[model samples]
Target: MLIKNYRTQFTEELTSIFDEKEIESFFYIILEAFHELKRVDLVLNPNLELDTIQLLQWETVLSQLKEQKPIQYILGETEFFGLPFYVNENTLIPRPETEELVEWIIEDLKIKKFKDLKILDIGTGSGCIAITLAKNLPNASVFAIDVSEKALVTAKKNAELNEVKVTFIEKNILETEDLNQQFDIIVSNPPYVRNLEKQEIHKNVLEYEPHLALFVEDNDALLFYRKITELATKNLSKNGQLYFEINQYLGKEMVELLEKYNFENIELKKDIYGNDRMIRCVLKS
Candidate 1:
């Protein structure tokens, strides 16, 4: 079958589930992932043909797309911060907002001229934050923790895929008392979404992403944040910094929570969409 005609059929079938632009993106993404073909290749050769086996593969992806499955999960990989990561139902697909959080950390560390620093990423699904830090900050040692063994498995693969070393730990943060070692920086983009906010989530996310990595009880929306902050107080080195990618609706509560821990130099920054998305604070020496 001609790739262009197949793309048109794929688009028509998925137009109800996703917008035209998204459908187009999925088409090209699958093309590259499955056949190593790019948009230009299709454009330059309008009659590009897919063999029977390749057509079957594309059709399988099309069916999954009809179910509103995320393209990343179907592809089993994604790119974050210019590096590749393997993802699955066990891990949340890395988001651009989280990339902003990472960029903020990298920029701050670079500006401070810090080196040989110790860093930890709590709830490191896919190890995106921890691995990226290790890859970019060659002088730093990175550690990551996740309660889900399956998620940690995927994260470990991602670390290897990115060719960066990160210590992966399997433990629930709320049940832990100490990190056993101090870190120069502690960061987390933990489960902050409230159960009540599930309706606000898209079907692709709510159905396809891991819930353990996405939600907290509404009565204790700060569950992970509070626990991690307490651990940071006891585990951060002098003048250490802490960062979080937070729920936009609870930015004020996050600030209050940090202050209660006596953290100084608090700062909350927004993502590209201008939502209050990330917070940074210091543990005073």
Candidate 2:
């Protein structure tokens, strides 16, 4: 019942499945979210105890974690680009690599002081990218689209929660012929993982994350990228930029793909882990 006792029990129970530090970290996260109690609270009040309902909450989370469910999904929320987002089985949890992509766009456009720019986020998932951009770049009009209406519902809630206005559309990119509306920037962190690469995924992700938002056929790994590029060819404004959070193994292939599509100033960037994880290209002015 005591906070310290629960912390130790939590780590011991999850030690076989997760690292001690990770379990401790997740414990602190849940602790704060559920009880508004921080690590310092446990230290200052060593006798602090969890009530019956709170103990049950911890038990439920532990059970889900043992099944390799993601903590974000267990909590039904996550933070992206320093903003909170609601997430569920329908959406892919936004990742740090995608935050880097958003930062790159923000840094470029903030310096340019672009006015009334239009930004589109294909496969928006939790609306993290669109809402973050709208929050950061007040001058930009943000729009996001996903094939799943369920994902869009969560994305819209996230936008409202963050107090930023982003137009959310439920449309499958593969079935669409054109974007119709031209945009100064278009970004997508689509389903880039090849089916063969499932071996490389973490159990928590491969088992719990949305497969529709993560994977593509091994024989056609670039299916979403190709379709988005085709749409960009028709819909990107003159001087518009295109960005993608790409699969690390496909950097060279992505470069060739963009070249074929006539996207200039193509730049492939590495994430914090030093893997080629993002690419940006601009239309010829």
Candidate 3:
């Protein structure tokens, strides 16, 4: 069948669930992934056709999109920090804001010219943070910790996929007392979403994403931050930095929490959307 005709059918089936532009984008994404065709290809060769097997592949993705499944998960892969990553239900899809967090770290460290720093990434779901850092800072040693074994498996695969060496450990951060070793930088984008914020989440996320990686109790939304900060105090080297992708609504509270731990140079940063989304501080010498 003609690819253009299939696109019309795909758009009609998902129009109620997604906007026209989104549906079109999904069509092109799937076209490239499954058929090696791009939007320009469709324009240049309007008579492009899909074989029987390719049509089945497109149909499956179309049905999944109609159910509001995220396109990344439907493809079982995603790009983060300009690197390819394998993603599944076991791991949370890396977000653009988290990429911003990674960029902030890279920019700061690049200025410092730390030739050989040790970095630890807590709750490293898909090893996005740790692997990206290792890939960019070739001289740095990177370690990642995740509580879920399945998540660690995916993270390990991502580390290999990105051709970065990251030591991944499976341990619950909230239950640990000590890191046993100091790190030059400690970072995390942990579960910070409050239960009260569930209503604000879209159906695709609420229904398809991993809740274990996305949420914390409403009454204790800062649980991960508090615990990670406490660990950073003991585990970070003197003058080392601690960074967090935080709950946007709790920036002030985050500063207070970090200040209480005697960290210095605390900074709360806003994402592109102007939400207070990340924080960084220094361990006092």
Q: Which candidate, 1 or 2, would have the higher lDDT against the true structure?
A: 1
> Model 1 over residues 1-285: C-alpha lDDT tens digits?
888888788889988778889988998899899878899988889988999999999989999988889999998999999999999999999999999999999999988855569999999999999999999998899999999999999999998898889999999898999999989999999998999999999999999999999999999999999999999999999889999999999999999999999999999999999999999999866
**Leading candidate by lDDT:** 1
RMSD of 2: 1.0
Angstrom error at residue 151, model 3: 0.6
Instruction: Compute the lDDT of residue 10 as modeled in candidate 2.
Output: 85
- Arrange candidates, best lDDT first: 1, 3, 2
Per model, state how many residue pairs clash.
Answer: 0, 0, 0
* Cα lDDT for residue 154, candidate 1: 94
Error of 1 at 198 (Å): 0.8
Residues 1-285 of candidate 3 have per-residue lDDT tens digits of 998888788888898899888887888888788867788888999998889988988888888887889999999998998999999999999999999999999999988755469999999998899999999889999999999999999999998898889999999999999999999999999999999999999999999999999999988989999999999989998779999999999999999999999999999999999999999999888
Better of 1 and 3 by lDDT: 1
User: Candidate 2: how many backbone clashes?
Assistant: 0
Clashing pairs in 3: none
lDDT of 1 at 207: 93
Error of 3 at 143 (Å): 0.2
